[model samples]
Target: MSTTFEEITRPDNGPLVELNNNMQEVFSQYRKMREYASYLEYELKQKDEHILKVENENSFLRDKHTTFDSNGKSVEPIIT
Candidate 1:
């Protein structure tokens, strides 16, 4: 005689089989959400580093431009 899948896995009761299937589905969805959260965190770190590099370059160029006047006289420092 051949036995069906449900009969072999859950011969005791019908409700128990349904509960087991539901639990498996919930766990699968949780795993995918965790992976997406990790990807977003990595992207945020890269953007922060790029912003700092641009700010440093702007400061360096401003200093070089204002170091001397057109008549070759020293220019007074401007307070931030």
Candidate 2:
């Protein structure tokens, strides 16, 4: 007597499709994060410029305070 065996094939599930869609959403979120970081860098540069300008102005004012009066007298002390 001879016995015959049948081969079985497995069916594909839909979970793989959902995973691909989720990966696409993650990539989109990553792009948005990069854009936000770029915007922050630009803002920081502007703030640095403003800070430099203020420091220079303060230095000029301090120098002017060191000058004596027309009668050759000392001036009042100014807070830095």
Candidate 3:
């Protein structure tokens, strides 16, 4: 639901109109902050997914090019 400025300032509410406007301003700010928070949450989720994908790819490549010697040390494969 939305309210126009004229409607919000209507004469019917009399003494309470001033208070009503203040409350409305506070609510408007709250709504904006909530929207920003939601956007940040979405971006964070996307970044986390990307990081996980990159980590997995790196692990796969590393294993493919690496070998374990009998001494329990990592031996990188040579591509002559």
C-alpha TM-scores of all predictions? 0.56, 0.62, 0.74
Pull out the clashing pairs in model 2.
none
The C-alpha RMSD of each candidate to the native structure, in angstroms, is 8.5, 5.8, 12.4
Model 1 regions more than 4 Å off: 1-13, 68-80
lDDT of each: 0.82, 0.90, 0.91
lDDT tens per residue, model 3, 1-80: 99666545536775598899999999999999999999999999999999999999999998888899999899877789
Ranking by TM-score: 3, 2, 1
Please tell me which predicted candidate would have the highest TM-score against the true structure.
3
Write the residue-wise lDDT of candidate 2 on 2-76 in tens digits.
989899777676788889999999999999999999999999999999999999999998787776788978778
**Count of backbone clashes for each model?**
0, 0, 0
Q: How far is candidate 1 from the true structure (C-alpha RMSD, Å)?
A: 8.5
Best candidate, lDDT-wise? 3
lDDT of 1 at 69: 78
Better of 2 and 3 by lDDT: 3
Q: TM-score of model 3 relative to the true fold?
A: 0.74
Give the least accurate 10-residue stretch of model 2, judged by summed lDDT.
Answer: 8-17
